[model samples]
Every structure is written in structure tokens, then in C-alpha cells.
Target: MLNIMELQQILPQEYPFLLIDRVLELDEGKRIVAIKNVTANEHFFVGHFPGLPVMPGVLILEAMAQTAIVLYAKTKHVDKNMVRYYFAKAEIKFKAPVVPGDVLQIEVEAEKMLSTGGILKAVASVEGKTVAESVIGFSVKNIREDKT
Candidate 1:
């Protein structure tokens, strides 16, 4: 439902840090499904392993978090330009290694929402096999107010 440009408008991450490539589906306040096209040229692959490159587990979780933030933005109708989303917590499990050339599909659902933030359940997979899953939380702050 959202393309890379649209995602860039909603998310704060830039190149090399923006993990999501495109969003395939989103149910406003409830859930989202996105994709990350991992490639051999990713910078992380250089040091993560010399001969064997694995997409970092943390980045997979980050993709999930970014997906959730998009849903939160849509659900709350908050302006990304006016606010910042902070990843607050996560409890994750890695089921497999994610390597280059794998299209990582991320799925996230809203578990609970508070005035300042919310909790979400997220999962990432490659070709239908789950690579990582987590329950993550985040908080949003208005940037304009913070400057005061």
C-alpha cells in the first residue's frame, strides 16, 4: 500500500539505515506487511562476516519496528515531520539467518496503544519461513515541543 517514497515521508531513517523497501499491505490501526530486498552490497555484510554474510538480527527487528511505526502514524494521524518515534523495547527470537538476495517480508500488528506509545507484535520471514519474531514497544515525542 505504501511505496519507498511514501515510507521515507513517514519514517526518519535514511539510506543505509532504511531497512524497508516497500509496504505491500496495511490495515490502518491494526497491522502492516512490508518487504526488504537484501543484497550482497549492503555495508553490514562487510564486517558481519568475511566469507559468510548474514543480515544482522538487530536490523530485522528494526525493519519490524519501522513497519509498526508506519501503522502507528496512520492510526494516530500524527505528522512524521512534527514528531519522532523511538524504539523503546523488544523481546525477540531469531529462528534463522537472513542473507543477501533474500526478500525479507515483515509483518507487524498492534497489540496495545497508549497515549505516548504502544506495543506491537512483529515477525520477519524469507520465502514463508520465519527468520525472526518479536514483541516491541515504542514512544512518540513531538519534536517541536522538545526544542523548547
Candidate 2:
């Protein structure tokens, strides 16, 4: 089990943008199970819908991607300073709406890897119900120099 602080050390994500809360299980680059606490205070709820707020499908995918990043970091043995990940492809299926106060269970598994890219499949669930699933391709490269 990886706590929030431990996960923080493995990934370069910060508050508001940090989607993963805790890692329940990990196999050092092969697979991971993580959790995200969805709350009413999430900024997206303000515009996503005024009254019937549902967590955006895109954001759920983002949470999955964030979990994948942790798996990649652990598997590649690359420190946060050395590498950055970009989303190359994502095929997502959203099966249900995620509301506030739900605990999302995110699971990611590495499907394959080569020198330049890798594929990961992930699923998000609430109360044992699958909410979304995605197969994401990621490419790793050095952090870009242009911040501006």
C-alpha cells in the first residue's frame, strides 16, 4: 500500500490537479490499484452542471491516466525530474455517472512496452460498479524546455 505522501514522491502532481488519493496495491510497474475521493467541492462541478453535477468522463480518464503515470514511474525506475509522460491515445467507455461523495476505485495494468511507448488499460468504479474504462497509450520523453 502506498500512502498519499509516498505517491506524491513518485509522481509530480499537485493539489487540485492531483487526482489519485491512495494506492491500494502495486506490482512495481505491472499493475496498480488506486483511489480517488470525489467531492462536491471539485471545481468542475461549478460548470459541468449547475444542479445535477456529475463528474466529467474526461476527468475520470484523467484520473486513470494519473494512476498509469505512477505505474510507469515505478516500472521504468525513472525519477520525477528525468521523464514526463504524454497521452498518445485513449479509447474510453463511460458506463455510468459519478456523483459527489463517491469513492472511485481506479485500476491500471500495463499491457505492453517498447523503447518509445507503452499501453495501459484502466477502469474506474464506484461501489463495485464500473463507471468507466480506457485503454491509453503513453509516450515518454524528457521534460520539454519551453515553459512559456
> Residue pairs in steric clash, candidate 1?
none
Q: Write the per-residue lDDT of candidate 1 for residues 29-120, one digit (tens) a residue.
A: 78899999999999999999999999988899889988998889888987878888878799999999999999999999998977589999
lDDT of 2 by residue, 92-125 (tens): 9999999999999999999986545589999999
Q: What's the true lDDT of residue 64 in model 1?
A: 92
Candidate 2 least-lDDT 10 residues: 139-148
lDDT of 2: 0.88
Each prediction's whole-model lDDT (CA): 0.91, 0.88
> For residue 56, what is the lDDT in candidate 1?
86
Distance from true location, Cα of 34 in model 2, Å: 0.4
Clashes of each: 0, 0
After aligning candidate 1 to the native by TM-score, how far in Å is the CA of 19 from where it should be? 0.4
After superposing candidate 2 on the true structure, give the runs of residues whose Cα lies further than 4 Å from its correct spot. Answer: 144-148
